[model samples]
Target: MSATTSARSARLGLRATPEQETVLRRAAEVAHKSLTDFVLDAACRAAEQTLLDQRLFMVSGSQYQALLEMMDRPESENPGLTDLFSRRPAWAKE
Candidate 1:
C-alpha cells in the first residue's frame, strides 16, 4: 500500500515513562513529524520487522538446497519435536 493511504492506519495507546515521553517528543521535533506521525511510523516499522522475521527466509544457494532436502525428508521418529507440537507459552512460543 502507498504510504499516504490511511486504510491501514491503526490507533494505538502507549504508556511511557516521563523520560521516554520527553525523548520521543524531542525526536519527533527533530524528525519534523508530529508526535502522532512519529509514533505511528515507529510502530509500523516495528510491526513490519516482527512479521518479516516470522514469515520471511533468506539463504545462500547451498543453504537453500539443504533446506529443500530437509523438507523432502520423512518426519523424524524422535520425540524432540513433541514440545514444538504442544501448546507453548507466549514468550517462549516464537
Candidate 2:
C-alpha cells in the first residue's frame, strides 16, 4: 500500500439503521467509491467546513489596519500593578 493508504491503520465503526445504510450504499455506488471511502471523504469535508466556519477568519485591509492601530496604542497603567513595583525582590532581601 502507498504511504497515504498505509497510514490509515485505524478502524472506525458506524452502525446505521437499515434505511440509512441503504441510502449510504446507494450514494457510494453513485460516487463509484466504497462505502467507507465515501463516508470518510464526506465526513472529513464536513469536519473541515465546521472548523473553518467557527475558528478561521479573514479581515479586509482596513480592518487589519484598525486592529494593528489598536494594538499600537500606548499601554494603560493599572493601579494594582504599579503598587507591586514598590516592593524589593525577595531573593535580593535574602
Per-residue CA lDDT of candidate 1, range 1-94, in tens? 1255467465568799999999999999999987877888888789889999999988899999999999999987767677667767678845
Tens-place lDDT per residue, model 2, 2-91, is 125567888888789999999999999999988888888888888889988898778999999999999999999888878888777787
**Candidate 2, residue 50: how far the Cα is off, in Å:** 4.4
Q: Considering only N, C-alpha and C atoms within 3 Å, which residue pairs clash in candidate 2?
A: none
Alpha-carbon local distance difference test for all models: 0.82, 0.85
Candidate 2: where are CA atoms >4 Å away?
Answer: 1-7, 49-55, 78-94
Backbone clash numbers for all candidates listed: 0, 0
Query: What is the Cα root-mean-square deviation between model 2 and the actual structure?
Result: 6.6
